[model samples]
Target: MSFEQFLFYFFSVVLVGAAVAMITVRNPVHAALFLVLAFFTSAAHWIMLEAEFLGILLVLVYVGAVMVLFLFVVMMLDINVARVREGFVRLLPVGLVVAVGMMVVMAMVVGARVFQVESPGRADGDYSNTKAIGELLYTEYVYPFEIAAVILLVAIIAAITLTLRRRPDSLYMDPAEQIKVQRKDRVRLIKMEAEKK
Candidate 1:
């Protein structure tokens, strides 16, 4: 077979394997690492398809930032996987129904030939995908984009706040509590009598 076909099959196999391993792995960290491998393979496939910008963005954004963030959160949270899995069997039917429904919907949309398999849009001379995306984002989708950014900002702040819930004995200062501090009460001098040696 051709090099392109070989590469495609190789990446596709790795991607599928990583994805399956990601879901099936008992260790959360290992699952997350598997997910990263899946993401890398997906980016490779995108690059193979000549969508250079998307491939690079997928690597930079999802692999570099999001997946790392996910892994850190998974590791840091100390989630009890066994406890979490306790209800999986009970929820199996619901999960299966949702999965099947989604597959059906996807099949309908894809099988109906809605997404025409045309030559990649940038097949011609020097068609700038980044420029086109920038123009679209700035001109047509600017408001929605800004709103989404604000929503994501709020989500990040909320995640930080939730994870930072501290005991009264904890040292981390909350700005809201700090604002109530009084200058007169700030520091008290403790008098220590001199001990005769």
Candidate 2:
């Protein structure tokens, strides 16, 4: 096998192992870190395909932003591993079924040689990856992209909503109440008794 083929197999093993570790790890924070490893390997695969933009985007958007956020949430939440694992035995069958079904579908698509390979060619001299992506995103795929954005926005709002709490004993000044206050409200004339301290 070629060096590239060997590298591909090596990273592919690492990617799958990391993914499995992400799911099976007892600690949520450790799981999240393994998930980062999975993302890194996937990005490496994309880079090997010469999709530099997509590889960088995968590293930047997923590994940088989304995975960091996931890791932070996992760490901050202090999730009970025992409680989470309680139902794992009951859910194992379903998980196995779903995994098997996905594997079958993937095999059908890929193992059947539906994707024919062409000889490697030199990179197009005039091709611009960013421009092509921009055109596709803004023109044909704009609606789907916008929908994804809205979904992400809603997810962010939902996460904040779920985590936010109010302290009943803590006093806070109302902005509207402050704005509506008059000079009389601000300054109270007090009659004080003069006393020797």
Candidate 3:
């Protein structure tokens, strides 16, 4: 086997293992870490396929940014693992069925070569995947790209709206109240009567 094939097999094994561990691990933090490993291996696969831009993006966006945020949220939150696991056994069969169905569909898609395209000539040093993707995104797929951006924006807003809560016990300062404050209101001079020592 060629070195490239060996690297592909090694990464593929690691990717699958990481994905399984991500799902099966009891600790949410460990799961997130496993997901990071999975993302890294997937990026390696992309790089092997000569899609360097996508591989770098996958690492920077998912592993560096999203996974770090996920880890922080998981670590900071008070989660009851027992309560979360309570329904796992009950849902195992359903999950397995869905997983199997997905695998079958993926296998069929691969076997059929539904998306097979004519292999282009090997890339020259001047070829750039990022530029090509950017041109397509801004030109042919502009509308769809804009729509996806809007959808992501809405989702972010919705998440913030859902998680935001105000507690009466917590201290809060209203911007309007602060703006309305005057020097006289903030300071009051008190006159004291003289006392004998």
Candidate 4:
């Protein structure tokens, strides 16, 4: 077998193992780490497929940023691993069925490709994937893309609104009020007689 084939199989195995570990690991932090490993393996697979831009993006965005945030959040959370695991025994049969169903579906889809006509030629590399994606987003999919962005923006605003509170006892400053304040509002001058020693 070629080196590429070997690398592909190696990455695929690692990716699947990591994905399974991410779900089964008792420790939340360990689960997050496994998820990161899965992401990295998937990125490596993308690289093997000649999708260099997507591979780098997956590593940078998911592994570097998202997984780091996930690790921190999972570490900070007061999760009860035992309690979470309690349902696993009951859920295992259903989970296994779902997993097997997915595997079967994937196998069918992949296996059917042998009978389909293959498209010729590779996509031009002159334009980066990011540029092509952006072009497509802004041109063909602009409305849907903008709608999704608006939905995400609304969700962010909702989260902030839900979490934000006005605490009467807490000292806080308003930037707008600070910016509008005159020197007199913040400063005071006093005259006092000197104390005799």
Candidate 5:
């Protein structure tokens, strides 16, 4: 087999293994780490397909930023593992069915060559996929792109709104309350008679 084919199979195996590990691992942090490995291998696959920009973006955006944020949140949050896994057995069959359906669809798409290219020739030396993508995005797909951005913004706002809660038991200092305080409010001078010690 060619070196390129060997590399493809090698990375594919790694990617699949990482993905499996990501889902099966009990520790969320370890799962996130496995996801990072999966992302790296996927990026390699993208680069092999001559989509260098997407490969780099997958690494930088997902692995570098998103995964790091995920890791931090996972580490910081007081997650109840037992509570989280309580529904796992109930959901297992549904999850497996969905997973199998997705695999079948993917296999069908690959076998049918649904995404076959019209021209398989290598791009010119001066050609830039980044520029082409930018032009297409800004020109033809701008509306959809803007809509996606707005949806993401709304999602972020919704997530923050959902997770934000005022805890009655937690103590918090209000800046306005702090600023309004006078010396008398904080301190009281006590007059006392001197006593012989």
Candidate 6:
């Protein structure tokens, strides 16, 4: 097999293995770590497909930022392993059925001949996928792209609004006020007799 073919299979296996490990692992932290592995493997596959920008973005955004945050959250959360595992036996049959149904649907859709189009006649370094994607995004898909961005922004705002709490007893300072504060609030001067030896 060619080097590309070998890399394809290698990355595919790693991706699948990591995904399975992510689902099967009992520890949430381990599952998150496996998910990071899965993301890295998928990024490698993207790189193999010559999607340099997307591959790097996937690694930087998902693996670097998102997965690191997930890892920290998983580590900090007090999860009850036994309580989580308690429903596994009851849910296994339904889960298996859903999993198999999804697998069958995926096989049917993905194995179809519609996606088997002829490869574009271009040399390895002839064309830029990023440029093509950017052109399409800026031209034909600009409305949808902006809509997605707005939706994501709204979701972020909603999440923050839902989670933010105002503690009555906690002291809080406004940044503008703090920035404009005089040294009088920050420093206290007290006149006292000098300490005698």
Residue 190 lDDT in candidate 3: 94
lDDT of 5 by residue, 1-197 (tens): 99999999999999999999988787888999999999999999999988899999999999999999999999999999988688778888998999999999998998786577575445568877788789989999999999999999999999999989899998999999999999999999999999999
Which of 4 and 6 is ahead in TM-score? 6
lDDT of 2 by residue, 33-59 (tens): 998999999999988987779989999
lDDT of each: 0.87, 0.88, 0.93, 0.87, 0.92, 0.90
- All candidates: TM-score: 0.71, 0.77, 0.88, 0.75, 0.78, 0.81
Residue 195 lDDT (model 6):
96
RMSD (Cα, Å) of model 5: 3.6
RMSD of 1: 4.5
Q: Output candidate 6 Cα RMSD.
A: 3.1
Candidate 2's TM-score: 0.77
Between candidates 1 and 6, which one is better according to TM-score? 6
RMSD in order of candidates: 4.5, 3.7, 2.2, 3.7, 3.6, 3.1
Question: Per-residue CA lDDT of candidate 1, range 1-197, in tens?
Answer: 99999999999999989987887677888988998899899999988977779899999999999988998888789798888778768887997899789889988998876587676576678887677678879999999999999999999999999998768887776799789998778988889999999
On TM-score, the candidate that comes out on top is: 3
User: Model 6: how far is 185 from its true place, Å?
Assistant: 7.4
Per-residue lDDT tens digits for candidate 3, residues 36-84, read 9999999999999888999999999998999999999999999999998
**TM-score, ranked from best to worst:** 3, 6, 5, 2, 4, 1
lDDT of 6 by residue, 93-114 (tens): 9989999999999999989997
The segments of candidate 5 whose C-alpha lies over 4 angstroms from its true place after superposition are 83-89, 108-114, 119-123, 167-197
Off-target runs (Cα >4 Å) in candidate 6 are: 111-114, 124-126, 174-197
